[model samples]
Target chain A: MKNRIITISREFGSGGRTIGKKVAEKLGILCYDSELIEKVASESGFNANYIKDAGEYAPGGFLSSAFSHRSSGPNNADYLWTIQYKIITELAEKGPCVIVGRCADYILREKADCLRVFIHADLSFRAERIVKEYGEREESPEQRLKDKDKRRAAYHRFYTNMKWGHAQNYDVTLNSGTLGIDKCVDIIKELY
Target chain B: MKNRIITISREFGSGGRTIGKKVAEKLGILCYDSELIEKVASESGFNANYIKDAGEYAPGGFLSSAFSHRSSGPNNADYLWTIQYKIITELAEKGPCVIVGRCADYILREKADCLRVFIHADLSFRAERIVKEYGEREESPEQRLKDKDKRRAAYHRFYTNMKWGHAQNYDVTLNSGTLGIDKCVDIIKELY
Candidate 1:
């Protein structure tokens, strides 16, 4: 009913980005997915590749090139977080927009107006999505799912210093793979 | 009020266990926390020590000492899940209770009477709790908090295939450290 901010976290193939785009369009609002990345890169003056790299490093991810080797030290965390916080806070202050990932829900935890949604699908459905999206890739469905989730988990963990998918962490956890994307959006629209 | 179940996810050292115990005592129901390990130990035939070790694997934790790892295959996830699922279902079927930690909220998501709550305090408050709990052997609150949470995240992820601590996963997220335990419980009780 009011101008609102909604943050979404979804599995790679769950159509979270697609659904977020649709919801923003339906509501006649701007949606931030890749755009948020660009803003994050521009605000931090970091290479888009680095922002993209750090974006993949969610809370659970440990940069093997850094943390594993014990070679990274403070600079890595500090450098990446600068952009992470800057982009997320700016977007929050900017206006209502749909964020696909980057733990936007956790990023805006203190904001009273934000509604956080966790969108997920069954393994089979998500696997099918990966298969369709990357038909050229030789990797199996299971391997693709694993890689995407691992990166997602790692990125979330490194940033927030919290676990990635505990249900207690989210506002609404749904099995979108089974419910279908539109039905999921309908339910979320009702929730908002 | 009708009988119901409350799922709690808390920051380490925030006295979530104390808060959960008190709430369960008030509601006249069982509180499942560490008890989950024992049940998993029994049902899965894995020793409690091994289950604890399996949990400690911490993300890539499995790659570290997985030889003794207690739940290797996807079917098993991790050792703690068997216990978590068993306890959650048993309690839900038995009637309402307060289930704490171990991703009880996610496991019991199917139940109609479930109320998921995340109780978190500021770092200083959690640090104080850990300091009090460990006494002379106590480590700095931040380190203790990180280790404890990593273990928790690993256990939940290995078992449920879900990330931990993201806000989108829970129904209501509250600042327990700021609100204090009594107020936290009271607010949850009112919501329930």
Candidate 2:
């Protein structure tokens, strides 16, 4: 699994994006994330506005959007998922890539080199992330972690038909709070 | 807080005993584990041997040696729990204890100075423990670990009237597999 396709499912503001970027930089490989979304839009020639609105942060969330588009008649889902599947498979077949999110691992499940990881931290760490990102914390740290976890769990289950944060579901589940993201990345690298 | 009571619930053969012992020694406190069982036996006068066998192990598990007195006909259940409760409270009131396995924390709910803890590990680790302890490596390790966890969960729930290993049930739920028991003990020590 050295030439690994790492899909990091993380809580919002958990520095997952930053970690993915670092991992990609260190490995000297392209990190497929929002870029995949961009390619998806261009390949489909769907209105950029539509893709931006549909593909960006979902106030309605993934499953709702997936379901809403599900009944949008033919070629809608096939087009969207096909674009995603194409980008992911292409990247994986290219040797190894660090994918940030967007059901990439689920799409590339057939690939033997895939390693799925869930990075988590204590409520305090997650809340601190949210606070740093927004500069104004609307929810208390405890409530924020719980709510985010619940939403992620529901979202993943809805989209992938799999349980979230379960030990069996992930090759490794880590508490980044214990030693920050750097140590976590090092551990993952060593494991690889 | 230095002398706060910490309840340690464990999966059987998860090295919980060794971990608790190390924790108690590190904290320079007597871990009231099997020692507490002895006190319960003497206090309840249900016969030291019978109560020892009965205390936290499966209630109806011992079909071999029935109680000599068998105090019953009325309030049988209450009589049984009363002795267990008595030992739990006495130990908490005396001072801090790394009370292991038994529901000492639940019994001392009125005490504000109690921190409940549950320790767990993945199947492989626990299975290895079973093999080491029982010398039954020939049997399926998977089935052994499953049976041990199931029995332990059933026993704990039956006695404590609470779901064992559920994070909400405890102040801290430590994964002993990731963090060895010693580190977990230190973390709990700091928390207290």
Best by lDDT: 1
Where does candidate 2 stray beyond 4 Å?
A: A1-150, A158-192, B1-3, B52-78, B137-141, B159-161, B189-192
Q: Which candidate number would show the highest TM-score if scored against the true structure?
A: 2
> Which residue pairs collide, candidate 2?
none
DockQ of 2: 0.10
Cα lDDT tens digits, model 1, A1-192, are 233677888777878888888888877777888887787788778877877776776322454532554444556545666667667777677677777787788877875366566777767888888778767477778787888887887777766776666544554555566457886676555455
- In model 2, what is the error at residue B95, expressed in angstroms? 1.6
Q: What is the C-alpha lDDT of each candidate?
A: 0.68, 0.65
lDDT of 1 at A113: 62
Candidate 2 residues A127-161, lDDT tens each?
88877776776667668667666666665665577
Per-model TM-score on C-alpha atoms: 0.51, 0.57
Residue B54 displacement (Å), model 2? 3.7
